[model samples]
Target chain A: MTHTVLVTGVSRHIGARVASVLAADPEIGRVIGVDTAPPPSLSSDGGVPLGRTEFVRVDPRGPDIAKVISAADVDTVVHMSLVSAPPRSGGRALMKEQNVIGTMQLLGACQRSATVRRLVVRSTTAVYGSSPRDPAVFTEDAEPAEPPAHGYAKDACEVEGYVRGFTRRRRDVTVTTLRFANFMGPGVDSPLTRYFTQPVLPTALGFDPRLQFVHEDDAVEVLRRTATEDHPGTFNVAGDGVLLLSQCARRAGLVTVPVPSSAFQLMGELARGAGLVDFSPEQLRLMRHGRVVDTTALAAALGRRPAFSTATAFDDFLRARDIAGGLPAALMDLLTRAVAR
Target chain B: MSDVDRRVAELLALLRRRVTGEYEVDEFGFDPELTDKVLLELVRPLYRDWFRVETTGMEHVPADSGALVVANHSGTIPLDGLMLQVALHDHHPARRALRLLGADLVYRLPLLGHLARKSGHTLACREDADRLLRKGELVGVFPEGFKGVGKPFSERYRLQRFGRGGFVASAIRAQTPIVPCAIVGAEEIYPKIGDLRLLARALGLPYLPVTPLFPWLGPLGAVPLPSKWVIGFGEPVRTDEFDPADADDPMVVFHLTDQIREIIQQQLNELRLRRGHAFPPFF
Candidate 1:
């Protein structure tokens, strides 16, 4: 039976890719892509092709979202609009409103729909707040020792709670929550990516936390798998290994200035307020004590393994960043010469 | 080239490799080369010249495959674990790297925690232990934990209760051997005469030990006493003989745990008998 898949947040890269891949599949009958704004169409960085797609301009938070879902008779709902960063200059509050209210409204729509069989929600590992008391690795069953205090992580935790409630009410729907680790790739833009772009990364003094990353391709593939396959329940999606914050900075060729924790937090706040970067308190907590998620369930239950390990993902990110930044080869040669002298 | 130039060149090369993402780091973020260059080099003097650790029954350590080295914990600073790592890494026939299971406090400390991870020390939990052993890595466990490390000078070398025999269950689950190990002289390194409980609570330390030198002598006094050390390994007690389901049996776990603890206590006693002085001026 061909599935009528309705993908939310088509304007976003991963969501667009998910839509594009599903639309191309022979098994999928029709794809319905929905977003508030039309996706970018520039050839160089154009959105992924939504082949045989019926584009619907509808806000997930609005009542119109229900009409779109009901009219399409969608069998699958892939909720991808849960924003990790401020999509535009809307600031954090707007993003939170979009995430929480949007998820609530969309789930309501899915519940109302009789045809919806599968629900794939894109959650994040940030739900597992970084704390000194946290276990070395968090399995799917492990509760967040300290709930995320603020920002996207908080929103994610709330979103998962809503998803759980939805699963109980609509027991027929297969709910797969993919809590992705800090994702990075050639084209991926995230808070971590922005943090690395800085010339001098200010690290917390005396603290070097272990970090994990999933390659953009791996993340997209995992998202695709949940949407396409029959895997149910929560899965912590991440690449195989971990990297140190210091190691990440070193690999990026950025000079690290170890600032005291209080001072570092103050600087981070200033940076975030100035819109110089996206530095949330949750990110600071992450830097203080890194969180690792166990992906044994992803392999065992989901029957999928990421192609790139954490270290390799980080390496690729650095390589892509260098090429993207257009760091001159001559500058490296000049630095080498000066150092030799 | 001069020794300084060669050393600098080697360091520079290592830095380049690290920066260029050539050097491999393991799943736990363990950089073997970096740990060797930095941590091993720093601990070499203390292991070789200072503590002067003498090892025996190292043949008990399997040439390959996973083995859990259950040892007694001592020393106010808990330097015994690091020294044990050095011993196995340097002395074992296969030069096996000991993946020590450290206390939570070790990972709570800032700079120290990062180094511990890079040096292949993970949180002393069964999940990590089970995984490491299954991967065929030799693991070290100090079951006595803080009770052993923070015990008073008068109670030095006295074994503490091994918490619930979690490590034994892990060994059984992994179907690996438990190599009982004991290290004497660590207890004398920083004899904990008293514990500043109030200060420790305020500072978030397990215990603020008041040694003869520490606080009184300041930072200089923090240097460990160069006591003669002996690390004795016992024959590997095979856990493979038992059914895997027996790991859940508390009776079996407790019995095996006591057996290993007794072996370590016996080794410590033997080493103590041969020791001449606490801090002999010359070896």
Candidate 2:
């Protein structure tokens, strides 16, 4: 049977990739991409008219979102929309409103849609909160960490509640919530990217905490399976590999600068106070400890290996920036000019 | 002089006898002295030098009766349970050997099964628990089961499913006091940062835990740091006091489970405050 999928937040990096992957699948007859952001210029490789995937520029919290989504004739709804930018003015409130009201709107739309059979919600590992140094691996069954300064995670979980609760009324629709780890790949430009890009990477307390990352492709694959596959319940999606923050920085061709724990804490406090970052004191404390997530259920459900490694993901990022071999040509030229001067 | 000291000695003697008798084997050319040697040498050294392992409310554990000791399972590996066994034998009032209710996977392994049996662990089955309790033995159970031990590092200290109150049911049938034990510092020993469920199922394990280092670092990852552990025993939930008919009631079981969970959580909180650190420093 040809599956028609409605994927929200399709303009975002992960969401766009998910939409493209699903649209390319031979089994999927149609894909409806919904996002508040302006549509990307790239066309689907399948040569299907970009308009066929119907990009709806409607706010998820608004009443029009349901009407737009229902009009797409979607058989499956993947709720991936969220305000994920580093918190701006009222970013936390926006995330909560969008996540909670948006999910309710989408779920309400799905409820009315006669063809909708499944709902896959993208959640974040942040829901697990900061990792403690002990028992480093987080399992699906563990208690969720208390809400952090980044309210997106907590709100996403609340969104999950709506999707999951909808399952009780609608048995036909299976809801799968995926709590993803740090996702990195081509075009990835998060704070961690900035950390790696820094000429001298700062180490926390002279001990670089361990980091876990998933390749964007693998993340998309997991999302694809969640949308099409029948498995229900939450799963942690992360890379198969774990590396120290220092190792990641070193891999990115940056020198490590050891900093005292007190200094790191002070810097973190200042950043939080300035609203430059969303991490809380508790989250900061957790950053000292490395978190390993158990991806057992995700791998089992997906039935494949992750598409990329930490090294490969970093390499892809470097390639995307056109600095795979060394520094970019422009930067190299500037350095040479300075040396000449 | 204290009841705990006398009981500890008795349990030590009992363990020694059992180790000599039922545990003695040379099938795989196993060293007869390995168990004793580990108990006395490897474990004792760390127990003495690394950190202070303390246990409180030993009297809560009945001195001469079969009691179900339900503890919060942590420590990515089962090191917490092993340490608890050592502490109970070295400090409890009756000093009775604890028969750990292990996951079925432990018994499924060849060498691991033999060693587990030698270590006095059996499948965490109701029948096994019932049989042991009826035999007037101390049966140790981590009702949080794999979920507690296998929890992601982010969700550390959060308890998991209590397994539908089977432990309570077993204790009630045997009229045993369910001694609730809260174990702190175990979760810090081997942090489980991620889980690869595919790998876990492929390996026939409950959850393939990616600890701080495991497969990449090999055995070093398995060697959990000896964190100062505090095993606080809460007042036992007396199953005998409850109506037998209430045993099947959902509300009765829920209340009992909640009470036990609260005790464990409270004790964990108190222990955390007492330590003032996530883990005891390793010298």
Candidate 3:
């Protein structure tokens, strides 16, 4: 297990934790963290400490990462830098460059580095773009019902394509792509987390798409476990079970206003414009047709189940929020009893 | 407490569970609690009173485990599936939930799609059907799809192409028995007299049906006729008798599909004759 690992996206929560955890492993001799900005000190996002990880700032636009990969003699590369949405600071263009081109540079570097034996790329289930034609449950091999056209989904798809190309070029490298479901935890700040935590959720009219979740703790655990070992090929990583958006709103004590699908996207933009939330088109379609992936392949590869199911993960997320509205608990209780009879 | 009090207490406890989100659904988003408590209760009236649906050969439905119920699809609006669901739930000895495989259009709609999934139904794709059968669920399929549903009123009960025999392949792969079911009287519910192609095209619907009272009568015509119904489940056609590899053989799939189609068609004719007029009392 003695290897020099180069971890990308060290600036983000998941990357920082993965780099920190891998650095802590005694068998792993060195960890080189690469990012545009320096690692956040004593990160409060999740309180994960950056342990003995040596940070290296390199411009993602250029071929500088290639130099770092070869010079550090990095044997294992953990590419966790892909962004799901255009960040508030960096808009869509910048986000796309960092996700797509940045991945290309990193994979090209990994391809040239003969020492790099294993590669773990963090992917999203969003690649399986939402549509009415989708199956009830998506297997790893299942194609997206509606192929992504733009935004973060297209970026993720392109990144996966480069990974596939790299796998073909570097046959010796064991590539593992983990397509994760919506990340839900108290510490996580995802598009879905923000959407769910809102006081009033504007759901797509008449659509209660089934959604799955992966807890932040379990997400870090999966990344850490795979970074150390070899789990070749793509796997859909998520907790067992699913939750309807309506059910989620009810459980979280939030009132939902159903907007027609025609107006849902516009409404999302209006909310975004109001500076209430960062609502992207990808997120909008996702809300309209919720995505759920099969996690049996993940369990088989990891040899264990995720710590939290979708329902419990959601409840865990709800515990941290100030649940202030919606129907009173007593009223819900009374109604349920009346309906049960 | 007496028996009445005990039942009341149990209902209250279950209601409390519902409020707390303490129920579970399978990976396919099938909520057994919601399906049994809410959905089944909603459709019970249509089965018991509206259509007065009667059943026969329910013994053929496996008491436990996987079985594929292949039935003829008819009626302009496709309410037969709902009535069939209610019938199986109430009449089956085990009261098993029949997980139907529906057309993509069923899911394309908004509120309708949500309720459909909560009621334990899924897309009519082979993978979903295969997974459901493998899990030992009583999977239901209407192979004729829009073809059977949109057939002319004069040609009602005439079977349509089952579409590549995908259902047969799914059942064979899962090694489940196929229970050929026939539902009479649904064809009379909304008799398709004409199809407005231009209107359907604009609406992006498969077919804009023109029933006697529909279109002319507007919303009033949307109401389904309360026709007498009979659902007969035939003997199970065992797929396990053949090797699972048989699922890959196109000829085997075609033969099985054709055989099931013939059985359901014949069953439909006999059941319709037994029930006499679709709208009358004297049989």
| The candidate that achieves the highest TM-score relative to the unseen native structure | 3
Chain A TM-score from candidate 3: 0.94
Q: Model 3: how far is A324 from its true place, Å?
A: 7.1
TM-score of candidate 2 versus the correct structure, residues matched by position: 0.52
Residue A265 CA error for candidate 3 (Å)? 0.8
Summarize candidate 3's per-residue lDDT along A1-341 as a digit string, tens digits. 74898999998878888888898899998999988777666735455577889999987878999999999899999998898777678688999999998998998888888799999999999899888898888899998778888788899899999999999998889899989898888768777888887778898998988889998779889988888888899988898888887778878867889989989889889987776777788788888778888888889888999999988888888887655333556776666567556
Model 3: pairs clashing at backbone N, Cα or C within 3 Å: none
lDDT of 1 by residue, A90-142 (tens): 78888988899999999999999999999999999999998765666788887
Candidate with maximal DockQ:
3
* Distance from true location, Cα of A169 in model 3, Å: 1.3
Docking class of 3: medium
Looking at candidate 1, what is the lDDT of residue B68?
95
Worst 10 residues of 1 chain A by lDDT: A323-332
Pairwise DockQ winner, candidates 2 and 3: 3
Going through the candidates in order, their DockQ values are 0.36, 0.02, 0.55
For model 1, residues B1-283, the per-residue Cα lDDT tens digits are: 6787667666666656666545666665578887777788899899999998889899999989999999989998889998998999899889888898887787777787778878887887766788789889999999999999899989977899999999999999999999999889899999889889999999998899999898899998899988899898999999999998999999999999999888888888887887767777854
TM-score of chain A of 2: 0.82
**Sorted by TM-score, highest first, which candidate order results?**
3, 1, 2
TM-score of every model versus the real structure: 0.91, 0.52, 0.95
Where model 2 places Cα greater than 4 Å from the true spot, the runs are: A40-52, A86-90, A131-134, A144-150, A258-266, A272-286, A318-341, B1-283
Top lDDT model? 3
